[model samples]
Target: MKIALAQTDIMWEDKKANLDIAETFIKRAAEEKVKLILFPEMSLTGFTMNVEVHGEYYETSSKNMNNDKSHWNFNRTLDAIKQLSIKYSINIGIGYIEKELEESKGKNKYAVISALGEVISNYTKIHPFTFGTESKYYCGGDKISYFNIDDFKLSTFICYDLRFPEIFQIASREAELITVAANWPKARINHWVDLLKARAIENQCYIAGVNRVGHGYGIEYNGNSLIIDPLGNVIGNCLEGVEGLIIAELDVDLVHNLRKDFPLKKDRRESLYRELAGEIIESIH
Candidate 1:
């Protein structure tokens, strides 16, 4: 399948400008005939945690009040995606913050809007980063989620969720391709690259990561968005701070071939792993 990673810079709370850019990118990706296009974390409004400034209640029909402070306003964004999907005839995965079930109110949770323009599944980040107590602003996702597009079992993880291998392991068990949409900063470029490769290698699945560019909230981003094959080889990537679509062709059978040759999944020591809960788990990257 042809997948395009839209490595665009977020507008840092500018929803209108961000939506405009998203529409343009969708048009560009459609022109290239991409089957799936992935955007960075919080693609519509960037990764600002200021709920008062960026959040709004989302509904099918609601007033566009600038002062409205809810979790997020996803109604407009969803309508845009529906229109674009019909126009482009392609699937898209974009991230955003949304008001959770009333039982989940006052917590932080990010959601991925599906290609059909409906929310197929919503995953709150399982591991929220604490460099600034991000979990405080959002509710953490309870479990790994996966969905199918054609014959592919696809899964997703948010920014800090990339650091946790257990999350990918769960997803990879059923997923042939895993895409992580992140707003990672520039200082951890090495970690980002290494971890992405590690995830693909360890899980034996195709990995596509979409990261933002430019700067936000005084933090600079090194946009090394990458697509890795099942063997953990980089097939395509973007340079830091560059704004463009990075496209790569991936095969579902390659994942099968790699796992067949390596047989890592079948040879797993799951019973022993439960006993080593406090011990360290190292990646093969």
Candidate 2:
């Protein structure tokens, strides 16, 4: 499968400007015959906690519903991208802050839309960046989701979820390709690169990490969007301090062959590990 990583600079809290920039990248990726294109975390807005301006309303009544107007700018952005995906016949993965009526706090999510312009998968970030006070504003998700695109079984994750290996391991059981959309800063870029490779190697699955470039708020993001093979080799990289699209072709057979050869997952002792971890947590508490 051919995939494109859109490494671009996000305009701070400017959805209109960001959507315009994203449209250009989507068109360019389509021109290259990219089957799937992935964007960074909060693709339309920078990592900001001001939910009132950046967040979209979850509920829309008929009284407020106009074909011309949306309850949230994020909805309009998705509408445009869905149309573009259908027009280009390419699958698109977008990261955004999703506002849900049940949860007024909103959550960080990534949605994958098929070439048919239908939402195939919607995954909420399981881990919120508490250090940055993200947990205060955004609610963390409790489940992992996987979807199918042609022959590939894919899973999606957001920025801070990259640090958790257990979730990747769970997804790897059924997924051959994993996508990570991140807003990782330059200061801790080394961690981003190392963790991506580690997940790919340990899980024996293809990993595509799409991170943003340039600065957001006061933090500098170096892009470093990467595509790693099952053997932990970097097949496609955006390098540091660059903004553009990076494309790579992934093979499903490679993941199968590697797993057959190594069979590391089959050897895992999940029950024992869970017991040990539980004990440790209990002891700490």
Candidate 3:
């Protein structure tokens, strides 16, 4: 299947403008015959800690939202995205903030929507970036989530979750593709590039890292969006500081065949690893 990574320039706290920009990329990718499109985190808003100003509510892990058109969802950014997916006949992986009961903070979430507008996977960010004060504005999730599409098992992760390899290993146990939606800045672009390749190599799966390009909250983000294959090859990437689509075709069977040929996972002793990292696996529940 072919996928497109939308490296866009998000306007700070402006949902309307960002949605318009996202639609343009979706239309272009659809014309290019892209099956699935992935967008950076906070698709309709830049990386801002203004939850009270920009937080929107949608159904949490609800599959019936496609059939039942709620009033707020019908007019909001997610509804617009759903309409675009149905119109373009493509699936989408995007990120946003989920409004919970808390007034000051929200849940950082990434979702996969099918071509028919079905909600496939709703994953919340497991590790909030404490260095950037994301922990104060975004609540972390307890569990990981995955979905199946086009005979591929796909998992979702947010920006800071890329630093944790144990969760990636656990998710790769079942997932053949891992999608990361991020708003990473320019200063640490090297780390973003290096960790993405490491994740793909160590986990033996496809990694799609989508990021924004322009400035947000005084931080410049030169988008280093990338797509890598199981053997640690850079299959798709775009020039830094540019806003465009990074397209690639993924053969899901390669992941299955590679694991079968190498069989590196068989050497892992799950019991011993669990004992070494006490209460880590227990927290997944």
| Candidate 2 lDDT score at position 197 | 97
lDDT of 1 at 54: 49
Tens-place lDDT per residue, model 2, 1-285, is 889999999999888899888889888998988999999999899888876556653335223445444443446556767897898889999987766434557788788989999888878899999999999999999989889987899999998999999999999999999999999999999999999999999999999999998888899999999999999999999768988899998899999998998899989999999999999999999
Residue 119 shift from truth in candidate 1, angstroms = 2.9
Query: Candidate 3's error at 255, in angstroms?
Result: 0.5
lDDT at 246, model 1: 93
lDDT, candidate 3, 1-285, per-residue tens: 899999999988888888888888999999999989999998878887887656667555344455454423322656777888999999988787776433457888888888898888888899999999999998889998989888889998989899999899999999999999999999999999999999999999999999999899899999999999999999999988989899999999899999999988899899998796777767775
Per-residue lDDT over 123-232 for candidate 1, one digit per residue giving the tens place of the 0 to 100 score = 66777677866766766768887877767888888888899898898899999999898998888888999999999999999999999998898989878999999888
| lDDT per model vs. reference | 0.79, 0.87, 0.87
- Each prediction's total of clashing residue pairs, residues at least 3 apart in sequence or on different chains, is 5, 0, 0
Model 2: lDDT equals: 0.87
> How would you order the candidates by lDDT, starting with the best?
2, 3, 1
